[model samples]
Target: MEQLFSKALSVSVRCRDSEERKSTIRVTIDLQLSPSAVHKRNLHVRLTDDKDPYFLFTLSISEEDFQSLKAQQGLLIDFGSFPQKFIELLELCHSEQEAESPRFLLQLCSQGPTPEGPSSLSVVETNAFKHLNHLSLRLSPGSDREVKDYLASCLARLKEEREALELRLKRTEEDLSRQLSCTQQTLCEKSKELEKLRSEWTSQTSSLSSRYSDELQSEREKALELQRRLQEQADQLRQELESAHRSSSQQLRSRVGELEVSCRELTERKYKNESAIRDLRMKLVAAEEEGQRSKQQVLSLRRDNSLLDSQVHEKERALSQLQMRAAVLEQEIKDKELLMSRTKDVLEATQQQKVSLEENAVGKDAQIKKLEATVKSLSEELLKANNIIQKLQTEVKSLVGKIKVKNTVTVSQEKVLQETTEKLQSAEKELHSSRQQLGTKEQQMCALKEQLESTVQKLNESREVLKTNENVISWLNKQLNERQMTRATAPEPAAAAAAATSGAKSPLYPLGRATLPPVGGALSSPADLRPTTQLDVAALDSKYFERVDSIPIYGLTSHLPKEIPRPAKASLPSAYFSA
Candidate 1:
């Protein structure tokens, strides 16, 4: 019995349901011989077929129970014969608590056999099995060879599963490395495309800037030419106006002087004719008194002849002499009357000539007043035109400053062009209004027709120049719009390239949707685009054109150049005559 308990024993715990189907739980039990005590021994039981080798349990059997188990080892020992002892031993060694209550059968077979068979089978009674359903223990193996063979097979299976897992891990790593290389190649290609786009953009910007600069230079030259021509025309008009005014004034002065001299002569002749008429009236009155006295003398002579008839021959000779004297007096009286009528006709003729001369002087004075009023109006218009020009120049300067500040922003450029167009339109309206005023002034100035005609021709030339300037401005606007359209279209490919390259490392491709620095550090600064220079040229051209528009249409005396003398205001003819 001691030798039997000391050796390693094969233990199989089988569970059977109500239908008697067995699921075996195999383990090994080691029962070592106790030298200190014969009554007790430690029974060690460990699972063999399970993956966990440490699944084990230990049980201690008392001296009486061990002796009974030893006494029944070679015989058919039934569990029902010693139900309490077996149940206690099984409870101590049962490691799986999850198994349900089922019928248990414990069978112990020894290596040495009886005459009946090589090993004896032990079974538990039905009544004992009902209470011992948690465990079923069977010790069947007699040697170590079977346990060694089972352990070897488990070791080989574990080694094969480990190798299979290692191979799968290696394959997954290779797939990841291939994907990484492919991503790197895609990033490199995207970077190359971005660089190409940047180069194209740079070239396009440079070409557009050069074209814009050339156009601006040509327009500036045209504006300067127009300004010089307008200045020359203005100078010529001023000279002509001055000459006409001087000559007209001198002629008016001379004509007024002649009229004054004639008036003085007429007045003097009137006084002389009155004196001659007075002398003739006195002569006629004296002749009439003499005739009355001659009549009285004849009456006295006739009375004396009647009284003294004796001396009749002597008295008749004296009476004949007196009658002849009376006939001579009558002839003299007729001649005096004819002389008085001739004097009266001469006085009437002198008075009529004086009246006609005074009417001519009044007409001349009125004409001088009209001429002076027209000159004043023309001067005022010129002053107003000058003021408008100054205002336009200031506006242009401010716009230029704005362009300089916001040179990179295209919207500001558009706004500047719009403002310029509006200012030009306003200037055109002012020019039209000024032309109407000039037309009215020309009609009033009939004396200066040739001068007005020359001025009108100059105005027409200015209008043509303005039209050309407008055309240039429109062309510039179209170019600007085209440039803006190009700039708008230029960024799409770059953005796409940036988005494509975003997946690469940040140090390799630094571009983003918001900020795209030039690839490979090629561009030094923003100024290389030349937008500022182009805007400057545009501003200068606009300023020059505005200056050309500023020239006064009606050349004012106050605004005349230093070389040209201004005409003096004409004075009334009456005042000149009076002075």
Candidate 2:
């Protein structure tokens, strides 16, 4: 029917979608381009067996083709066209079961891109199955439950990996501490070297006492000899002093030899002492060089330490931010899970509704078929009955003519009686068959009613499920709101807890003490929770004291001046109120 009623022509097709470029094509029906009035340029594609060569309209596009040869997609063929051709193609493609394939046909028609051009639209050469898979994945964002679970599992694994990374960082910090301790030991050893050098100098000075003692002994001996010589000088001038002079000369020679020995020993000792002093100086120079190197090393170490500290600080800040983000993600996951559950509920309801609709459609179809059959049968029977009446009328006219003309009434009556008997039997048989058919139809109707009742019960179950889902959604929403409120003011509870802990630790207040007002609406911002020491310091600002005398702070607090400077930092969380 399609081939006889319509004409099919060859066309070109192309479709391109990429992240880098976006293109949309619209057809122009200008005669200059189309040229042919019989142009099937407005293509409505029918999908046939993929293996068939004629199934595809091959389009030749250049390798550098950038423009999407497509129009707005309205079919699964990767393009769209006029509805007439669309329906025709659908009918051809699913001739065996067009009714069952309406949805599939509709989807194919809708998802196909709209084309624009008079040139031949070639068949899209890509795998149709692959495209269908792509569509499935794209739609799976809402439809696929397993994907969500997989994502959740992945996130959990990532959290574990992060925790492991943190452990590694802590281990690295421990190694750094050990390295620092070794550096400190090196510094201490360098300090000890200077102390040892000072001690050696002190010992050298103490050793000079023996040399001083030897010098004192030699001087005393020389003075005694001189005194002896002076006393003998007056006696030697007189006659007969030759023996005394000889004794004195011998004593002088021995004394001179002893002095020569002592001088040689003193020279040796002086050389040894000078060498020791040079060695000490060398050691001092080496120590000074080492001290300079150590100083450089310390400076570099300090720089490295500072750099590491900054890095650590930055990492810690980043870690805190990541933790906050993780918390946010966790909350998001909760919300998503809730949404998934809601979607599940909606899907179940829609499925039940679809089932009910299918059942109703089936029942309507069955009824229409039954009515059509009854109408056809009745029409056929009416026609047969009219023919029978015409035959009977002709027979009655013939029989009357025979009775009047031939006087054969008895013979004619016998024939008439026999014909009437046969007719009566035929009518009774028809009546019995009609009654049986009516009974069968009635039974079918009752069965249909029972199926409908069952369908209604299923529908009611679906409604109840929907109501339960609604209640769950409401509860979840309430909880979500409460969670959001608590999260927004997270610091308040933390600060309050910290203050209480601090008070307890100081032994100045009892544990669990409530400092806030019983009925409270305390500020929740970071500034509001900054340390009390900061608040006290701000309260002492000159501007704050400026109007202290005029300002009321309980009557006992009148010691303040008229005014003082306001707090240096307003603090982001702090809000000012007019008196």
Candidate 3:
């Protein structure tokens, strides 16, 4: 495993140039180890490939430490050799200084006797070089004393630097708090504007829909009244026709009864005349001839009665045919009424579509305005962040200049002067690190700007989509209206009703997802209106997708950029101690 670890070991260190006099020189050291070693140490290593090297660690140290460490002798001088003793010492320092940053220290020790105390400053002792006696040398008593004194002076300077850093932190905190309050106030104002717009939009939509419904209801009532009148007229005509037929049949029955009585009386008289003629023997032949004439007359009377009955039957058949015609006319009128009702339904549907489109258009305008406002707000925020970053950079530069001036002035003070110069260097390094952090913040701001631009692009694409949808809906509505008008004018009631029903079933307003607000609710500044769109979503409905409201409009809410967290107050002092 050790052999494999050695083979896999690949580390590189990069140091920033000292010519720039940048306080802290970033030294990046990358360590790659073998799989066996990684598993044994339980290291979180990143590997390029299974057969390739795995990166185990990357650490940053100051340029001065890098130089001093490189100038050392023994096995530590070899870059490829793993410094187990040095890693142990760093771990020990970290454990001891868990509550505070570990101070910078350079001390030498040999593999002679193990250090006996749990002191914070313990030098690393190598145990792998037993064959080299010179490499096992220890620190002399006099050098140790000098090293302790130097450490004491350095510690005193660090305390002073810490005090200065605390004052700066308190001032920065006050500034940040004030800025945060201002941002919060602005956000609240935007939210209020959005709420007002939403309320107005909802009210308008409701009013329009209610008006259309009322119109539809009134039209339906008129159609019903017309149908009732037509039905009444048809019923009156049928009643009159029935009464006329009943009176005519009654008159015919009376005439038939009168005719039957007269015929019976005539038959009796003929019978008596026949009996008298028989009584007279002399006129036998004459009586016989009279009887034959009477029989012929009776047959002619029977034929006339049959003709009257046939005439009565024909009159009744004509009346029945008239009644059938009246019933058919009534059915036709009823079908026309049904068709008229269906046409009204179609009209209502079309009107509803128009209202929806208007609402959508208004909503889109509002959303666009809202987005613009949000963009403006974001731009303002970016400007603020940039300003802050600039201020920080300038402060760092000024601090650097001050440290330089101090170092030059302290040069003549002898022992105290040298100690002050070292302290100034440490302070400069801290300032440099802070500047680097500020640079990082500036980069974050740039990324945020890029995100805003991307969101704007997406919003534009969405607007285009809404426009196309609107056009398509309008065209469809036009076609439906035209078709309905034609059907309403058609004479065939059944055909008209069928056509109207078909039209009514066709969708009036096509459903679409939109993130924009309605246009009429415009506030003073178009740019400031953007935040309202986001705020309106939460206010409108918690579950819009599952509600009837979703039928009309849906919008993807664009989230705002995350704000950077405030920096800690002790960071600068901790940075100094680390240096």
Candidate 4:
């Protein structure tokens, strides 16, 4: 077996001795193994086929009637069955080393007839090796399937264990929370009992204090009334005794009157002292009532303060619970943050690995992108080339349209560039001129700067002038308004003044011409004259004087101008001279 294993010896044998023996063969074995040590002629193996090679096979042995056939295997292989055995061997292979190295297997299988004698095992092995090449591929279906099922079972068991642990933790937490709630309810019942006790105690204390205060007040009132009654009795006795003493002393003793007067004075002082005592007792009663009210109020405040303190304690406990909850929440947040950090790190690592892989492929990708760009450029070039070819072929319409657009664009660009260049040149020249202008402007600016002070002085002078003019206008407006107000108040006096000036001389006047005389010798002044057009005052001496000759007279005095025309010389009415 050792020499055969070293050379990968193959052999085949066919059944020829007994047809029934070959027909009875139902199991086959073809293995691939490498020999560890081939020195032992009679080997003791712990596993079946340990001396041979382990290979896949189909054994038609009944479990109820099986012999220990594996230990005493001998050469009885059929070459026709060898193919089925070799493929079964390949499928049953468990190790990579066993499958990769094509080790020869001993044929410890069913007996088969052969042409040669017992020495024909070598030929059988050779035929078996050649035939096994065909059937080796059939091993694929069954051999590797078992390991997958086994691994799946192991993973399922592990997952079940984790789920059970999670369920247990959840149950524990629920139990703890239930216990905490029961504790809190018991505490609440206890606090309620304490509050009831305090309420009963405080109520009894307040009632007792109020009753004591009332009893004390009644006693004080009774004492004050009795003292007042006694004072009234003593004053009556003193008055009666003084009347008796006075009557007796009038008859017998005038010196005893002084003694009686002094006793009356003493009684009066005692009455005043008793009244003061009564007032002090009343004040004490008032103070006791006020103090009792304060005591009751203090007791009420203390009870309220206790309730508030208990409420504050409850609030503090609630705050502590909230703080604990907050701490838990913070811990949860931290856990979430830690999980996120780990996840982020994992994600970043994955991304970095992806980036590294991408970087590893970057040259290829760049090449592909470049190829794609080159392909696009080539395609574009091809299109351009095609267009040029079309142009060469005199497809001028499309080219002309493109050329027209390009020409327009070029023209506009050229115009814009030319305009910009011209503007730049003009700006440069303007800059030079402006530089020169700046020097001239500097001199003018200095002159203007000096003139600015004088301008300020002039502006100040004008402002003063404007102020003065405003004051003058204000004064004049006041006078004018006053005059208008007086005229409006006495328009009849103005008319009367005008009439008197027309007919009579004024004594309190400044000018002589402003008034007319009572006699008709002098002509009326302009004040009395009727206005026609503008008066030719400078040119007139006699036109007005000559017109006066025609006036009509009233009792030999003319009121109108004296040159009164004779109207048809009817007899004069006597009414004309009645004045």
Candidate 5:
């Protein structure tokens, strides 16, 4: 197992310059050592910085002291106790020529003991030198008298500097007071100026308001006059339109009567034409029927002629078969020929009758086309009359619409004028209210300034009280210390107990009795103690604890009681110590 301990030391190195002047520099030394090396009767020490510029020399420990350090790790070994060993270590670092010659000779002096304690050396281990131990030597300040004198001089200098700062602070405070007075005067003057400006603004606003009201009155008068004029004009236009409407209506009635008479005459003529057309259509239908009958008759006559020819052919064949009947067949054939000629005449008569009926139908169709043309002309005339009536009605409606638009425009203009006047009045009211608000805000600012001045006075008084309290607290701490010393040095237990009982009744022990635990008992927490009012100094001797309950000491009521468990060391605030 490897065990190592590192010791930190402050090293003082003294060296001579080229002019033989001695100078010293203090540097921290870190030493690390392994216990194994010391157990083998060999001491190896290493430094944190092997190439330290200040500590160029070498150091070592004796075998006995090395063994002792191994056994007792906390032991401090002083190099000054063995000057010969230190000198030998120094000699090993310098050459013979360097040591004998004046230019390179090294002078090493061991430091004497200091008032604080004896100067000691520690061992440090380094990885660079595992088989050897290096040492750094340092000396503390020599005596306590010299240190006391130095501290006294420093305190005197600090006092002088503090007096100078106080003087500077006083001058600065005086200057600030004068500036504050000047600012206060300027603020008063500005307030007066603001009041004057406010009055002038109010006067100007009043004048502007009156002028605007007068202008509004004139505008209202003009609007009323215009309204009256528009009404008169509308009345005149209405009368004129009524007269024109009456005349146009009479003329329209006469024209309508004339158109009605013409329409009646045209309708009567239309009825007569319609009757003639119907009669012609009926005759044409009858003739078409007669033509159909004549067609059938012609077809019948042709069939009869074909039958007579066939009979004549049959009679001639019989005559050839019998010569004695030849005369009878010839007479029959002459009869059939007469019958065929009579049928051909009947067919010709029927074809002529069909042609005559077709001509009559065509004439009737021509008459119907002429009647439709006349009816179309009459309808066109009626449409023209209807368009004229519609135009007159549209013109009358346009005139009425123009009158209504004018009336609406005038009414809207009157309403706009009233709304503008109301807006102006509201603007005036807003300006008045804003001025009032500004005055109120200025008053509030003045009140705030007065409150700030009062608060500053209160703060100054509190600071003075705090200084007095600090002085009293220091005095109480000194008293508490002296009492503790007396109690600790008391000889006999019976006497010490008597002294403790007496001290508990004393005014200085008023808080100690409440805070301290009973003999041989554990201390109770502060929360069990009840808070009380500030102690009255005059009542300390007579009425220390009027009530039986424990009262918490001032300033020791919080975590202070927990932190300061010993009653002898715990110091209460001035309120409890004041007498």
Candidate 6:
């Protein structure tokens, strides 16, 4: 069956009069079977060309015209045959002379205003009002009081919206200011850090230059000392050679004089006596033979002296070579000393870096341990929360099962579940936050581990360098001992060799002490040779404890519910007691 219907369109109307530029008026239309029925249906058709700020007017038409217009879809009505007000509205909406677009819109609404009150109507009825009614217009304009009330309500709503927008704008401004201040503080801190780094760099450069100059001066001094010692040794050797030459010449002169005297005596004896010629001749022959023997002995002595002179010349050449070798060894020792000094400086720098890294590691370990404790606590809380949730669920199920028998208990259980749910939510939030914190700390630990590995690599490199230097120094010491043995006589050379060994031991003592601690737990140094500082042991112990404390373990019963429910009353006790 076809159903009776009404339709209405509410439109904000703008009209330009001769004096006024533009005026806004609210217009509503209703189309139905009768005027009385339109009022009864609260179908007010409000339209006005009045000068007031607000107005309401009603227009009602017959059912025949409504049906005819409804069949035509009502979008393009024949305003040529309609009322004057309707024609005026259409003209105002489609005026060609108006430069500006229409400032009004049409809203299709289901219900219209009535004399008694506002009434709700079906969409079919409203559509009928718009589409199929005859032109029998009956208008009821709203009183000035009603119009003033509507305007007042609209103004109040606008004021409230304006205040709310202002409040939001102020909050945004505050947030921006807070962020700006935070950025400014961070920038200032960065600038300060930059300046501090620049100053440290300048100081380091200056110290490096001074150390180089000092090393150069020490090397020069060692060279000059070596040269002076070589010169003294050369002068003493030349003097010893000259003295030996003078003594040999004197001995040869004395022997020659003695031989001349012997020859003279023999000549005198031969000339003085001829009477005892035969016996004297025999004695003289014996004396001449003895003299010849003595001369031969003297010649042998001269040959031995010449051999000694050759031996002395060879010793002098050996001494000169030894002196040259000693000079070379001294130069090498100086170089080794310089290298050792540089190694010591590097070792000290590495030690400081190691100490700092250890300290940072210790701090991180402590933080990790603290986070672990917090995580443990959070886990406990979560377990407790979960246990509570389980209890609540069981209790709620029990309560729901007996809800018809015990509404009061059900109500109480509901409240308990609500509280438990809130607590569970809070616990979960804490767990999430703890998980985030753990992730961040783990990242820090990984970064620290990387830093520690890098430091260990640097330390290993330094240790190898120091070890190589020590070996070179020891070799140089051995070379020095060899040179000393060649240059100095037997007892003196022995003493010098002992002294060289002692000198070699001295530098190694400090080098071993300095390099040992940084290479802890590594077999770089023998157990006996490692530094025996109390502080180092204490620091190691502390680091070990920190590591051990960072990790945590849980027990199976840690999350168990604290309370157990009691057994219910006996089922057959009442009947048994009665029997």
Evaluate model 5: give its lDDT: 0.53
- Displacement of residue 517 (Cα, Å) in model 4 is 99
Q: Give the per-residue lDDT digits (tens) of candidate 6, residues 69-153.
A: 4455553553323444453544444342243433322322223332222321111212323532222233444567866775686
Q: What is the lDDT of residue 3 in candidate 1?
A: 20
In model 5, which runs have C-alpha deviations exceeding 4 angstroms? Answer: 1-410, 491-495, 498-536, 539-579
Residues 26-68 of candidate 5 have per-residue lDDT tens digits of 2222233435543223223322222332232222344545434
Per-residue CA lDDT of candidate 4, range 328-398, in tens?
A: 99999989989998998899899889988887896888788889987885676456555544544453344
> What is the lDDT, from 0 to 100, of the residue 52 in candidate 1?
41
Task: Give candidate 2's TM-score.
Answer: 0.15
Of candidates 5 and 1, the better by lDDT: 1
Give the per-residue lDDT digits (tens) of candidate 3, residues 1-579. Answer: 121211121211112321211111111223434455212221111111123112111222233333344555434443334344444444443344333333322222222232221111123332444322222212122234544554565578789999999999999999999999999999999999999999999999999998899899999999999999999999999999999999999999999999999999999999999888777865877777898899899899999999999999999999999999999999999999999999999999999999999989998998999999978856775676566557656765666666664443333445554555565566567656766777798899898778777656655544554454466446446544544454456535765555555546554531211222343232233223221111133222121112111111123333321221121223222110121
lDDT of 1 at 149: 56
Tens digit per residue, CA lDDT, model 1, 451-474: 667656655655554565666556
Instruction: Give model 4's TM-score versus the native structure.
Output: 0.14
179 Cα displacement, candidate 1 (Å): 2.9
Query: How displaced is residue 516 in candidate 4, in Å?
Result: 99
Q: Estimate each model's TM-score.
A: 0.14, 0.15, 0.16, 0.14, 0.18, 0.18
Residue 139's lDDT within candidate 2 is 12
**Range of the 10 consecutive residues with the lowest summed lDDT in candidate 4:** 40-49
lDDT of 5 at 572: 35
Better of 5 and 6 by lDDT: 6
